[model samples]
Target: MDKHELAAFLRNRRDRLQPEDVGLTSGPRRRTAGLRREEVAVLAHISTEYYVRLEQGRAPRPSAEVLAGIVGALRLTDAEADHVHLLAGTPLNHTGWHRRDVRPSVLALLERLPQTAGFVMSAAFEVLAWNDLAVALMEDFAARDPEARNLARRAFLTDSPEEGPLYGISDVTEFRQNVVRELRSAVARYPSDPAMTNLIDDLRDGSAEFARLWERNDVQPARMLTKTFRHPIVREITLNCDELHIDDGDQHLVLYSAAKGSPAAESLAFLDALGTESLNSRRR
Candidate 1:
């Protein structure tokens, strides 16, 4: 919670990582472990002094490009990159997406974004309710399978021996990384939420990477995220995300948009079909 604590945590983690851990060749006469400040600077494409400023807490925030570079250089787990965002004060993650009572104005806005996939989420990262198109892209948003369980726990907790996952049973690294990053974005703002604490505990016990990411205590604000998703149903789709705060209520709405003439646009249309199915099933 405290900056000093954050700084210490960052330092401790940097020391724990080995050059080999990040695919760097271990040099002879390496008296200490982990990446040197200079090595991180070289990899991140920034000067050693600037990276030192970040590590020393002299720099209050880093630009998105710099943050990305730091992520690549430090091998900051998704959690760590997220932490950079939080420490930087980009914005609050909450968009009041799950509030039961939302102003008509906000709801109107959410409804108007027909070309984009959108939803309102709680501070808890609960997929309260998403638009027709949004549901199609994020399959989990469409799933009425369970409450209290989100993608993070589902992806990391379920084992191959159990119900089969689309990504196969073998240890999946990238999926784990995405989930960790997603969770890290939420963790920074609402650390005290018991639900989150429990979620992290389950993740820690379930995967080594999850445990490592959690231990770093990186807090990051999720904003304007542009990510690619490989949906089992839709193939690979890339979209730009925008999280908008509902000024009146605690809820917030997030929308994913693709270019007008792109494959992602087609995917958005497919999502509309899926949302119809979801509504129809409920009717039945």
Candidate 2:
């Protein structure tokens, strides 16, 4: 178990709750920003001393029942509760690294997707494979060095003013938050992966925004059903986003498509016909 992280997570959650939030009276002269440690302990049915130690990172791994009590006491969201379980429970075996390879069948599937911009993203947010239309809609991933293909890096580390915000997608802030949340879970799952650890460290050290969001201790991502891309070729095109989890490899097949006969659909078809070469030339 990650004792320190669990402690920090609990403390952060505890600090966000008000006394009345838990149906407790805000006694006069209350000085604390949120509920006190003692208040949390009382609500969790644990000793004040124990809860204090848990927050201080000195307590042993909490029992499942104790964790459940704390979860209730903190009023953590479903995602936050899962994060608590992950941090408090015995760590998963870190024997293998997160997979980066796309299954051949999945690669072929990307090619077969008609009128869709399709790509496979690894757990680390690397664009592992892409269809022709994906290249036209997004950047030409094949031309980028493998490290540059990482969406997380593109989300935060892109220093070029010309690059705009990650494919000029309309939801940069939300995307960055989701990236941080997903990476937090990824790092925990792959504690031994230098690549994973290093990637997160780089992001945290390089981007103040990333560091701030990381401290929020969020684990869940808000669902984004559609996305808008401000493409040089087609201008603004909105597409329905469908994410298919390749659980076997811990990858995702992301497809961006529009409803048939929609303006966005016409734009996608035009981009597909133009292809990557034409798109690249236009950018140049």
Candidate 3:
């Protein structure tokens, strides 16, 4: 917790941002290189004097919420937000637990439910483990390069098939926003992990849409929702996506299922049969 480093970092970030960047209009006679201290305070919902004290290295340690507001106001990148938390002596998760392995029990659960498409994802959204049905429904995680297995990276960083169905409906803006919001928390939670850092850096560099959304600083916890996937074979299938959180490991077991007796359920069963047939053929 170096006060000097924190002060300097905050000042630098503030100076790099222009007024227009944060929805403020610069006056005709304005000559400041970036947003004024008062403007930052207003945007961050803090006192002007308190912000000044922060920049002067005289303020007490800021709470997590205050730091989050500042991060949003400054439009800092995920990496930068993590740095601020570190410098403030309030690490996002003090336990320093970043697990890449799925528990055996979790894997067994996936195996037992062959009809369901299930996968385990790290806090950083990396595909740590996935079942065959999951591969048939989504892209094959095993075949992809390790760095490309991230959900955020796949959603924003790369181009999708023009004719193939995507994760959500035709308008995927909301889905994209949700991913960005969740990734923001993930970055803070695993700041020092190389995989998380590299994924963020790549997304920021390769995707303009991603870069724009990242600045919005929207943080949301994971939620259960119904998702529609346009699988090339199954066509349009809507399934309930539920997340089982493994708190100790900071991982999630994402399972996709359709209600019994529904068309979607039938499609899932057909898809599972197809997957099995394909596996038997490869064994020959």
Candidate 4:
């Protein structure tokens, strides 16, 4: 996982940059991630051969300064930039993983607002954990088997298209693009995760649609996206889905709450009724 993560992070970091973004021209047709090897080398003030070696996993180790240059040239985010340094194995003064059993403070604050529903998901798109309000508001997770999660894995599977319907989104193309990008982001973080690699392999081999999208190598940071979903019991509701790139690393907690007494609230009420009915039926 160590070397693999380094490679994945490098791959994702490079693919996300654009020629125009780095003040270069995308004049000619080329097949590669974001910036070409030569372009990135030029930007980072290094030799193209050196950069290629890094990407190909031939370079033994990268210095902090070198990692910084690469991150700067790529215009990576604070999180993405941190990942670059981590991948380089240039340990910073202090580094560690998410603290155990500490629910995101945002979850507590959100719990106070009982009407609002939200859940924090890992960057891997696993429902790392969610709040009760979140379960109540989000249909799929309400009775979700703890074992069944991971947004990317489910997206590529044929048996569980129900998850897509849970999002209530109809545009399969747009959804696939977002899921792929998100998964790529996680891949760099959890390079050894068998589930992540399995999802990629299955998608590539199982569906031609997945193969076509996989080849594009387009990476975009999905932020503050307002998506609409129609729950089975809720009828119709719109949510302002904001993704928080938890400063802690490839971890995130998504908050979904309604804006006052609106259609969303009405929908939530309906959903609650449905959940109650399902629970009661089982008890009987």
Q: TM-score for each prediction? A: 0.48, 0.67, 0.61, 0.55
As a TM-score, model 4 comes out at 0.55
List model 3 lDDT by residue over 1-284, tens digit each.
67889999999999998887776889898887998999999877789999999999999998776776677678675577789999999755332325665667888888888578999988877788888888777766776776678777767766866423244344366667877888898888756555567878988999899999899899975464977886556678988888888875678899998899999999989878877557445434
Q: What's the true lDDT of residue 211 in model 2?
A: 96
* Model 3 quality (TM-score): 0.61
The CA lDDT of each predicted structure is: 0.61, 0.85, 0.77, 0.62
* lDDT digits (tens) for residues 122-241 of candidate 1: 544455566666655554455454343254655656665433453231334554564566667655544544456677777788777678876776554334466576655666777886
Candidates 1 and 2 compared: the better one by lDDT is 2
Worst 10 residues of 2 by lDDT: 90-99
Model 2, range 1-284, lDDT digits (tens) per residue? 88899988888888898887776899889987889999999877789999999999998888766775676678665467678889987432332356665677998988998999999998899988899999899888878888999999999999898877898999999999999999988888766555788999999999999999999999997888999999988999999998989976678999999999999999999998887888899998
Clashing pairs for predicted structure model 4, backbone only: 15-34, 120-253
User: How big is the positional error of residue 11 in model 3, measured in Å on the Cα after superposition?
Assistant: 44
Candidate 1 residue runs with Cα over 4 Å from true position: 1-105, 140-149, 160-192, 221-224, 232-234, 246-252, 270-275, 278-284
Candidate 1 has its poorest 10 consecutive residues by lDDT at: 91-100
User: Which one is best on TM-score?
Assistant: 2
Please identify model 3 stretches exceeding 4 Å from their true place: 1-97, 160-171, 221-224, 276-284
**What clash pairs does model 2 have?**
none
lDDT of 3: 0.77
Q: Give candidate 4's error at residue 136 in angstroms.
A: 3.0
